[model samples]
Target: MTLDTWTTRLSRSLLVNGLPREYVCRTTREMADHLEDMRDSEGDDDASRRLGDPDTLAQMLTHGFRRQSLFGRHPFLTFWLSPIPIATFLAHIVYLFTIELIMPVVVRLYGESEVAFVSGSLDATKVVLVLAMHLWLQAIPVLLTMRLYRIIASRAARPWTSIIPAMILFLLYFSMTKFELTWPSGTNPGNYRIDIGTVSGFSSQPVTQGLQALFVALVCILWLYRVAGEQSSERESAVTAIP
Candidate 1:
């Protein structure tokens, strides 16, 4: 393989093996320099042979680094079975409470003003706040959970162990949680509701959330499959490139 292709594969292997980006970049540069020197002394043909395969090199480089941290060494335990889920739930509660406290104060302060500009600005602000809160309450938890799942899956030896449960948890959370923001009418301060369990009603909210969760899960699965395929291809190319 060409030197450029070799280095490119090496960089990807390093990243897949969980080395930090800065470290991978620095190491790739050093390897390229070493290869250049080897070529100068032994010619192009022998240089790559002596330099070793990218996948093997990446394994050796990351072996020590991976053992340095608990998260790196035991990603499934540290991330999947940890307190992160509870913390995320509590954080959402705190977020709702803060919004509840702040919005009423904001309305009381601005709701009484007779100035046309102030009234118009309050209406616009209310609209923006409602939209922002709706999106955040619905999307943030799923996004955050999936993000953690990605990190853990990338580092864990058996990714499916975490991926399935994580997806299930995300779907449940999305379906159960309810968030509503009502705009203030004249002489009345606005109100917001955040619920975390099933409501006794025939509502479409659960169905909508279910569909959204499924779509997000499908997308994440596709992305993981693509990444796995690319990594496998890179390894095959690296192996075949060996003389």
Candidate 2:
């Protein structure tokens, strides 16, 4: 192919491989300029030979864009924070509405909490349910964050880095959900009582919510790593299977 044709091919290939349009435009222009400059240094044949074919070059670029270093993964939350994961964010909104529907049933089943719970009030059990549900809502953010990272990480990158967001999200949810306080109730004029407990550690409660969140974060990290690893394996197998 001619130089222009080759550049066009590379540009199209990069676009097809999911690169952003602006990036593709800028990159293709720079590459074309470089090729034009080198056109005189050696014959077109030698230059083409050195640069390789459009298909090969595009594949190499795609590979580089996809791969990320393991250590850089922890602090690489920028992309996760940007672009707004629309699908997953919408899913979380759906989840919010779903909770509105489902929690009433959950409360009705848990205790005589339906009336208070549905009306946007909280007794001890209702409060626990709300907190737990908030924690569950965290799944959306972590799941979306995982997907975003997966797009950038290489197949052989081991998916170990996805653990960071998963763990952080888990701790965030866990800390918010972990509730410790005393509930005062008076059933008779002369008698009063203090009730205390949590959803899990109803007794022997931990004093610090951070400690509980940290433990939960560990669990989240382990689970996320296993899940991401399995998914990466399956994807690789599928790609390999594509003849």
Please report the candidate that would top lDDT against the real structure: 1
Clashing pairs in 1: none
Runs in model 1 with CA error above 4 Å?
16-18, 42-45, 83-90, 93-97, 109-135, 144-168, 179-193, 197-243
Q: Compose the digit string of candidate 2's lDDT tens values, residues 185-218.
A: 4642121111111244423455545555555565
Each candidate's TM vs. the true structure?
A: 0.56, 0.41
Per-residue CA lDDT of model 1 for 49-96, tens digit only, reads 777888888887777666766666875665556534653575476467
CA lDDT of each prediction against the hidden true structure:
0.59, 0.52
Top candidate on TM-score is 1
Candidate 2: global Cα-lDDT? 0.52
Candidate 1 residue-pair clash tally: 0
Candidate 2 pairs with clashing backbones: none
Q: How many residue-pair clashes does candidate 2 contain?
A: 0
